[model samples]
Target: MTAWVRGRVQGVGFRWWTRARALELGLTGWAANLRDGRVEVVAEGPRESCEKLLAALRGGDTPGEVEGVVERWSDAKRSMVGFVEK
Candidate 1:
């Protein structure tokens, strides 16, 4: 699953947050900041894993509040690389 997340996500360690959570869930993908002040995430794994990642991205059991989450499927190739901020 993929997400084009907006709102007050940038400059708040959103990418770092996602990397940590994704690693915890054993997910593989990339999360980066868009030029338009949004966060673009590309994730791949089992459906359950993807859902968990999305849920965490939306609003995890953390202090950061996710203002909004826009999820969608994408044709991007899955990364065999480790999670990292980009």
Candidate 2:
């Protein structure tokens, strides 16, 4: 599944936080900053792993404040080589 997260998701180590969680959960995906001050996440993995990713993205163990989250399920067609910041 893929998610397009918005709100104060930039300049606050949001990408790095996501990268760590994705790696820890063995998820394959890419996360980057959007020009519109939002964060874009494309991830694929086991169903459980994807759930964990969603939880983290929605506010897991991270110290940052996640005011809100916008989630969407996609085709999972994209293959992630590595988690990156863009």
Candidate 3:
């Protein structure tokens, strides 16, 4: 899963929170801050777990305001190790 999150996400521990959520979901990937003020979250795991993360992202329980979340689904590559904030 690749999700681009927008709105009040930078400099507010969004990446850290995302990493924690991903790790708790047993996912492996990275959440990175884009230069354009968006956070790009990439996770590799079971479909169910990914969906849970997505739900959490849009569930309005995060540190910053998540105006929107645009997600893309794809085949897992099995290349990621642990979740990290990037």
Candidate 4:
């Protein structure tokens, strides 16, 4: 699954927070800051776990306000080992 998180997502430790969250959920992928001030995240794991992460992302964590979350699902290409901030 790939997600684009908008609104107050850049800086404020958003990438780190997302990395930790994904790791906690045992999801593997990456999160990175976009030029348009959005955060792009790609994660692969159990459907339920991915859903949980999406919920949390939409709800926002500390220091960042999650204005929106847009997601797209696709078939897994390569297996990921750990979540990271890219």
Tell me the alpha-carbon RMSD of every candidate. 2.0, 1.8, 0.5, 1.1
C-alpha local distance difference test of each model:
0.79, 0.78, 0.95, 0.89
Which candidate gets the maximum TM-score versus the true structure? 3
Q: Model 4, 16: alpha-carbon shift in Å?
A: 0.5
Q: Kindly report which residue stretches of model 3 are placed more than 4 angstroms away from their true locations once superposed.
A: none
Per-model TM values vs. the true structure? 0.84, 0.83, 0.98, 0.93
For candidate 2, lDDT tens digit of each residue in 1-86? 77777767788888888888888988888888889877888778877888888888776455456666777776666556767777
lDDT of 1 at 48: 85
Ordering by TM-score: 3, 4, 1, 2
Model 1 per-residue lDDT tens digits across residues 9-81: 8888888888888888887888998999888887877778888988887665533456678999755476467
Candidate 1 backbone collisions, by pair:
none
Model 2 spans with C-alpha error above 4 angstroms:
60-63
Root-mean-square deviation of Cα positions for candidate 1 versus the true structure, in angstroms: 2.0
Q: Model 4, 50: alpha-carbon shift in Å?
A: 0.4
Per-prediction backbone clash count: 0, 0, 0, 0
| lDDT score, candidate 2 | 0.78
What is candidate 4's lDDT per residue for 1-86, written digit by digit as tens?
Answer: 99999999887899999888899999999999999999999999988899988988987454588888899998877678899898
